[model samples]
Target: MLSFSRTRSPGRNTSPLAGGMDYLEPKRKSNVLGRLILIVSLTALCITMLKNAPSFTSPTSFSRSQEGVTHVLVTGGAGYIGSHAALRLLKDSYRVTIVDNLSRGNLGAVKVLQGLFPEAGRLQFIYADLGDAKAVILHIPKILLYEVDKIFSENAFDAVMHFAAVAYVGESTLDPLKYYHNITSNTLVVLEAVARHKVKKFIYSSTCATYGEPDKMPIVEVTPQVPINPYGKAKKMAEDMILDFSKNSDMAVMILRYFNVIGSDPEGRLGEAPKPELREHGRISGACFDAARGVIPGLQVKGTDYKTGDGTCVRDYIDVTDLVDAHVKALEKAKPRNVGIYNVGTGKGRSVKEFVEACKKATGVDIQVDFLPRRPGDYAEVYSDPAKILRDLNWSARFTNLQESLEVAWKWQKSHPHGYASS
Candidate 1:
């Protein structure tokens, strides 16, 4: 269902809901949780990796060592989750290096980090575009392997957190091949570079969208993956590819499948913004492909009347802080295993209205919403069965419920409406 070229849009533009992918609808449905979750998924697809590659953390990005501190490199560290994790690692006393393309992420996020951690003694930032695969692969591996002048040698990094990806659902749908190229293939470039560098501990930001709509509620890590959209499918492909690499490579991989990752850094430091409104990822796609997938007018509803509390959709919402904390904890893990999968979410569920209410409470704004129709290829209600993660990671959501996280997000939004760009 595509039909256009990939030429860049002139400026800011908002389209119809096209289901929950494009915009939010005002009306409520019978399946409260179901509809609610779909709504949250929109942002989730942006924040973490519901549409993106789930944000990851490098334990030793800056870690205490008998000698001094472990060097840590963060790809996409300028972005929301990456910046937050990067800042936390630096604060915890790890020497951190951030490499960002500055497409989806704001350079401002890195500025906040500079002011936050102060002292460039332990932190380094690089503006590297991964889009040029050959140049990137050749350049990064050399840095990781030999330590060069432009690439800061002498610092042996203990690990690398891969958070770089071109993430955008609607855009992905419009041009599936492009999303696959970056989110899936660009990651391959990172993996290859890391493999060549021999970085031991590598944490990945995978996503729950890999599972798509599940037959059972509280979907577990073992849920059958039948991604409905190009974005979800791309994530699934990335997970599979990473797993394969782990099968052969000696990389220590922890694959975290994030649910709805909401809220800010809690310390009022980092938050999510995309290339679209708050900003969505300025997605990369071939121009011919863009013209191929013509945008459908009005809206495209996948499914409205489901058997849930709300007719819309329901999703598991987790605090961004909780997610980053998990990353910092997983770093101490020292073992060679196939990519381990973990669901990051409060096993609890929340409706769209519930999330909105919390946002309203936090921001003290009743943001306008217009209801459209149901979206195809979407789940009725999907929450995480994070039991396995709790048992293994020994980490649970301490951020309370959806309302609590939303309040924190709202608070951050109120203080910095346009995100840290204002600051």
Candidate 2:
């Protein structure tokens, strides 16, 4: 599966496009003519949105002294990483509101939220479109007002975590503008929404793709970021806007650059589940299903001849549990700087071949590995230097290696083979 981490195209993205859902890439790439169509489509979609709910100008206002429990709204909270993050926030006594359009989120994984907290409804599941700024406006309480124009000035928000983005490398390569607009423009919307609400804190889910292929071995936080793909461009754009917002608007922020996130929540609840990519065989029955759906050729093994020991691409594969822990720690470690960057990974790199061998051993099934040429926007060997996060936040990875990650991954995939659709 093409990792959703924003990867830029160095002119061409060889990875599968359009969420990599098989061969459906033609309609996604837009020309000047296609832009006209997209404008019309967006306009029509906006009209339909008006029918979904009443118009609301802004968010509701609370007294400056209101000391109620801090509310954390996580957009895209139903996503793979966001799901775990939301659960962690809830457990740590932060009230969470999850807003996802279900375009990429599973309703079953969402149900897990309710299961975790019978008052799951407290974690709002807003079905509003981010593309429709007015629709996004309607979801907020009528208190949040526009900051500059005072058009919608009655709003106030404590914190917002923006995780919603079109995170596909190959898709961005084919339709770079689509990725840029969807991610960068909508991110502008999200930040504007937060700024309007006078949000105190913001967390952004970012990726390592911004670094592209750096000249160094270990990528540090301060490494020069020159993302080669549109997905990376979009993230870099958002990151820049966020920093600008913090300077101009006093928004405290954390940009988490996630490495390869593997494993599922242990209870066999959630894992790396995309709607289209399903594996008909082995642990990635979900990925195999995508093969059936023709989104991907069965088990594509990208290049395996780097200077690494295994001769395959080596990457840091962090477990979901440890990944979630970093987020939790970030909440408490908010510095006066108000904006920080952290690379969240295990720091230990593993190869594709090694990963497959481990999976085969854990699941007790010999999986297929159709080696293919190196996909576009893929780094040969990249790992994290997690020293800063550990030293600063005292957050060390608990789940040490790939086996622990895969054990949970296999269990979760087995239980929810069809993903949230199973429930």
- Highest lDDT against the true fold, candidate: 2
Per-model lDDT: 0.68, 0.70
Off by over 4 Å in 2: 1-68, 132-156, 277-298
Q: Give lDDT tens digits, candidate 1, residues 32-111.
A: 77878889988777676533432233333333333666677788999878988898898788788888888778898898
Query: What is candidate 2's lDDT per residue for 297-397, written digit by digit as tens?
Result: 55667687777797788888878788888877776667544777999888888888887777666666656668868767667877888998888888878
Per model, state how many residue pairs clash. 60, 33
Model 2: worst 10 consecutive residues (lDDT sum) = 143-152
Per-model TM-score versus the true fold:
0.73, 0.75
lDDT of 2: 0.70
Shift in Å, residue 43, candidate 2:
33
In candidate 1, clashing pairs total: 60
